[model samples]
Target: MTTDLEFVDTQVHYWQPSANDWYPTLRSRPALYRDILPGDFPPVAGHVHVSAVTAPRAFLDETRWLDRMRHDTGLPTAIVGTIDPAASFEMIEADLLAQAESPAFRGIRVFSGLDPAADTTLELFRLLAEHDWIFDLIARLADVASYLPVIEKSPGTTFVLEHAGWPDGEEPGQFRQWREGIARLAAFENIDCKISGLGMALGTMDPQRLRPWVETCLELFGVDRCFFGSNFPVDSVAGTYAELITAYREITAPLSEGDRHKVFAANARRRYRLPG
Candidate 1:
């Protein structure tokens, strides 16, 4: 790694349990069906594990598992837990309180199918703001623009878009739509882009080919609002973990050392409130 190396990988998943127990949907993606623990990654100063499965009862349990891992193994300096936006507020609050007990708990990430403009969603944003916890937003690229209204209204909430807004692909039409939606979301000072998980849909792992997407994000969100998240074993579909890091390093090489540092580690430290 170069000087000011970003040792904090903001997005890493420790895949545990069998496909049936951890995430049944993962069975379709054999690369991610197996266990991917912290030991699997290259050495890093810190890691943040986003929730993969968000079943209500299992949600807090998963954070607890991660907390235990951090204490025992000493990676993932922080944890971004999960919440079921669809669940009743009382139940969600209980789970959140339980999760907050862990010092590593930073916030929760809710997945797609959320109505960006729905009252429920707005209320969820407010709930997160009350805790000053990070709100990890996941939406389909096609539907990304639909979220503009709600995010605009919830200025107090800290929003982090997951997987480049989950672009389904980079074809002309999809690329145009993804870029437009991402630009729109980037307009909000409250939001940050988690530059992770793109390998799931993208075909090649070459840094030059991938540079366009990464550059587009840097251009739109600026380096301060963008950070590296390997998305680990899941994103290994794009390339091996080492290859993914190499590609990011290659793509971001043009940045100044400080800006480069922010993309790799510093920004996540600020956004997730991780200690130095």
Candidate 2:
């Protein structure tokens, strides 16, 4: 099954003792407490890490910690660091510029799911544009309407919508909302979507159950605008690493080999500016 197709798991996270208090369940399990180092990943060419949603105020500290861990353990091909969109544009821009010095710092993430209508988010988008940093927008499907105005305002910034806009469960109306919202968001050239985190968002242990949302994301974002991600640790709650990748493969099988490669690696490389 070995083709020349190298993979880069673009959406995993590594946790530390500082994150323990936020996720008490994860802290209780020593087996799960181990940091997701490079060795824990499948034999891939590289990986990119998205910051976990703990300690929102300490984003810079988290980035420093992750950078140290990446240097010490050789984990993560790159990082999507967190920024509170509520911060002033000057502060956010300064923080982003500082993080850009780190080789592992690839982009910035703002969890739109937390506060759908946070007014400061528009400023955050402007900061992303000023620094030429990618913005990982984490919003619930229902929140997509709230983000549309901001997305429209920041046309120059590259936006990666996480979890297919974090679609709701299998309810027909919820699904329709997600589908329509994504199509609307897709109209913005700056926006792309990652086909990850569905299992976690759906709270399902079965990856097969995520087929509909995954299919819808591909249909909306298309291969060029979409990329695959493991969303590990978070996704580990739903299924194992192998299971996650296998599920992605099963869902993307209808696409051509080149398109699959884009989803698996090329799109991520381009999005994060990873070296080939």
Candidate 3:
């Protein structure tokens, strides 16, 4: 690939699941039963070079591990550490401010458990906006609808929807739900979508099979708002890192080079404020 075609794997997890407190829950899923390190996913040896990665929140103290990965591998350009939205505003603000002090820190991620219309959740959005941090949302398909109000309320916050809302295109009524939910969420200008982690649900790395979902995401959010990600190790449960990347490439082969660049790298860099 040309230098300009270098990829930015937006979502990857480098952590020891066994040592994590959520090990019991994670281990139940065979794919996440072991330690996954930088060595596990070396630069693809020519096909695609992972120039940078944006790792989402992990099970334990994710920032400590993420900083370790950056120090160790010299990749993982930024990390979205976990946050306890339920904590007091004073506590959360102090913690987020301290975390922002790290060069590796770009934002904080929270599961979509908060009601979008709730006063408390709106306050959390304001807190993130105040810090100029991104809000990485790990939400299930059903949770997308609830986030619309939050997106509407926090117009200044850049909210990224992980895994394209975890759609299972093969399941009956699954795509329909994803289609409607995603379309609604995509309507919000502040929202962006990451095309990652689908292997965990799609069960195959066949680009042909994933084309519809991937294309729909692009069509709904457009090239500027859509970005590609490997969702590594976790996606490994269904396919290899190379396989997922190849699938993404194949699914996007028909697009114009400029559009492909946006999905493959540019969008992530711009959205996450990654260093050039």
Question: Which should have the higher TM-score, number 1 or number 3?
Answer: 1
Expressed as tens digits, the lDDT of each residue in 151-220 for candidate 3 is 7889988788888888856765888888888898888888889888788778888888888899999999
Cα deviation in Å at residue 105, candidate 2?
Answer: 1.6
lDDT string for model 2 (96-191, tens) is: 877777888878776543354565666666767876788888767556687787788788889988877887777889788888888888888888
TM-score on alpha carbons, each prediction: 0.93, 0.86, 0.86
Name every residue pair that clashes in candidate 3.
none
Candidate 2, residue 134: Cα displacement in angstroms equals: 0.7
Q: Pick the winner on lDDT between candidates 1 and 3.
A: 1
Q: Which model, 1 or 2, shows the larger lDDT? A: 1
What stretches of model 3 exceed 4 Å from their correct place?
1-4, 17-24, 44-60
Q: For model 1, how does the per-residue alpha-carbon lDDT over 69-126 read when each residue is reduced to its tens digit? A: 8889986788888777677777778778899999989888876456677787788788
For candidate 3, the TM-score is 0.86
Q: What TM-score, to 2 decimals, does candidate 1 have? A: 0.93
Please identify model 2 stretches exceeding 4 Å from their true place.
1-5, 18-34, 112-119, 205-207
